[model samples]
Target: MIDKKTYNEIGVHIPSILLPKEGIDMQKWSVVACDQYTSEPEYWEEVEKKVGDNPSTLHLIFPEIYLEHGNADERIKRINNEMKRYINEGILVSQKPCMLLVDRSTPHTKSRKGLILAVDLEKYDYSAGSQTLIRATEGTVIERLPPRVKIRENAILELPHVMLLIDDPDKTVIEPLAGKLDSFEKVYDFELMMNGGHIRGYRIDDGETLKGILKAIEALADPEVFKSKYKVGDDKGVLLFAVGDGNHSLASAKVHWENVKKSLSEAEVEDHPARFALVEVVNVHDDGIVFEPIHRVLFNIEPESVLNALQDFFGSSCCSLEKFDSLESVNKRLSELKREEAVHSFGFVTDRSFGVFTVQNLKHNLEVATLQGFLDYYLGKQKEAKVDYIHGEDVVTKLGSKPGNIGFYLPSMEKHDLFKTVILDGVLPRKTFSMGEAEEKRFYLECRKIVKD
Candidate 1:
């Protein structure tokens, strides 16, 4: 198969946990990643009631909503206890080591296929100057790591909702595995609760298929080829294995491992399950994948304050476009303005008015780029201007239209440019692209116990 020996040499194992036949309601069992839609508690609450009393992943995990109010310590204790209980109860059946073929489909979309595998953590580096084989596509918010570390420190299992992307535009790696999915044994097939839709998985044990995947990954890792593909002067000593989603979760694993490494031996470190976190790898050019726009929300900022700030930032050149009653209307105007390349239209839904801010650029870069720089500086001075990245424009309008709220609807990043920008420039603006809308995210169904102590 793969250089399994190389992985072993690096002290990592690809242990897998599969769903039982009788308990195969994966849709309910597999919830979206804990970190997604953190602002929406009702969504999590609905999942709890639907998953109640069943052998669901919800039972074994703590929703991030409850993490606030000084309850995190208690949550971690309960999570650890439940993990131990699940393993002791023999509820989790271990599967033979192999790659997993995943296909997820929602009501409005077709199947989204992916391959699940473990990457060597030692090959990854998240630091700004890191030239590690595995790299982050955006700036990592360092402050988000501590709370995640607290959860992972005693986590008995690790389930991945994070997917990594490879720059292979051709059908080189994942496409071949998709063809063999039907030949392999089906591991899970069911509907996901909360309109998340149907999800099915297959195990890939064929030696030839596994070898192909390995060869493709190895080719991507070749320093000469990678540099030539990106047209960089030097290799930068890094491979563009991007964290498409779940950047914080990977960061969490990194943080905990560093802290625990001080007390472990070389052998112990190699054998630690934490050394290999499960992740799905997809080709960047997959027809099913799309980079959706993530918007910004500033809460507790008055509508008048927003107008004042806009007036101050752009002076008399700023003109307020007609108020949009619906997101569709706002989007139409934004599209119309984007064609001009000389003006920028911002959709803003405030208490005083639902309107667009048409600003003729007096200075700076792209309109969004210029606006972000000023927002960063403004929020730096005023701590109450809390910023959030929203997945849809509708969400932007819905959340921003609330009292004491303001929102900035940004355009989507062109998917084709993502790889080139990262390879040539080293990094892109943070939160530049989202794999898909919120529901398209990886679900948390499988789990690997990282710390058995």
Candidate 2:
């Protein structure tokens, strides 16, 4: 990550970080990304009981499960107030301007390396077909932006769970920090609540170390290097950072920044606090990084209606549905699928039926795209029906098995194809891939002052 002057080139910089004061129980302080466990109220219920009035991040973020409960404006007010209160009460303290090296080991993954920094919103565009330095790996859902923007409107602080991905196959940017852990100050080391696993952070304030990281990031961002890596010409912009997790959150931040900068003069915009958003940068090749498929669950729609909609969306000939008695068999068949590129298979589940839906001569490269195209068209026509991107196979299965709900279990993406695929093809369909399952996600720990006093 670069400092303010060069943040434009890499779209990343050392940020003025915020952390809980010493003696605060990190176990109760840090929680998983707000977006996770949306379909399960029980999960959040347990978390609330554990974090009960403990001055935790639970107070700072509005979990998605409670999004529809009511009083959204009131919730936003409470969030902004908590941010200011934390600052006033010294519950949150500024860590000065610096970067952090993170070593997180989840129950599922070990020693997953990451760098905590801020990304220039000006250098990021979440729209599809974006050629910016930091582009979203998946399509941005436009409707998801307004609510998120509302959360940031009056909020003074941001606790970022957006994990950005870099195609650093040479292990240059973040991996090198593991060897020099002794050179940095250990900031926080604790177990995350709710089986999120253990994590430790080291502050990177060394000039020489930061300089080396900047050089490595610069080399990766070189236009020639991007072209050579993707086998493309110089016509395209170099895509160094891809939004792997928290796509909508990052998109909302970009939207918020765009709105704020419009009222400011050019001079004011240059060093504006809201101009950059905090994020964790992780190498795509890191051993801890794995692309889990994001499953889809349709609510308030019958399985038969869903099938008919799909049939109408993609002409009957190219689309076919074959029924199965059990999910196990459907999954087995979908797993054995190694067919032509154009042929795609998906595992489908409903209260009454389990099936495999196949699409021939696919309109999109991935199964998620083909299905998302249909879902977008279908949902536009059917207001009562809505889709939610799900993580963890069990949750999706349970939700999909509920009455009046349909779940489409998806296949995972190959990590090797991510960078080149994004470079050649504009972006994957929204909710295409997740870094890990629900519990493995990055918890809200580091905070940054997004607005000046």
Winning candidate number (TM-score): 2
Model 2 vs. true fold: TM: 0.96
Model 1 per-residue lDDT tens digits across residues 325-423:
776787788888788766766677775556677877545434455567667777887787777777777787778888988887777777777767666
List ranges where model 2 is wrong by over 4 Å. 1-5
Model 2: C-alpha RMSD to truth? 1.7
User: Distance from true position, residue 179, model 2, in Å?
Assistant: 0.6
Q: Which regions of candidate 1 are displaced past 4 Å? A: 5-13, 18-21, 313-326, 342-345, 358-369
The 0-to-1 C-alpha lDDT of every candidate, in the order given, reads 0.73, 0.88
> Each model's number of backbone clashes?
6, 0
Error of 2 at 365 (Å): 0.7
Residue 56, candidate 2: C-alpha displacement in angstroms: 0.9
Q: TM per model?
A: 0.91, 0.96
Lowest lDDT block of 10, candidate 1: 6-15
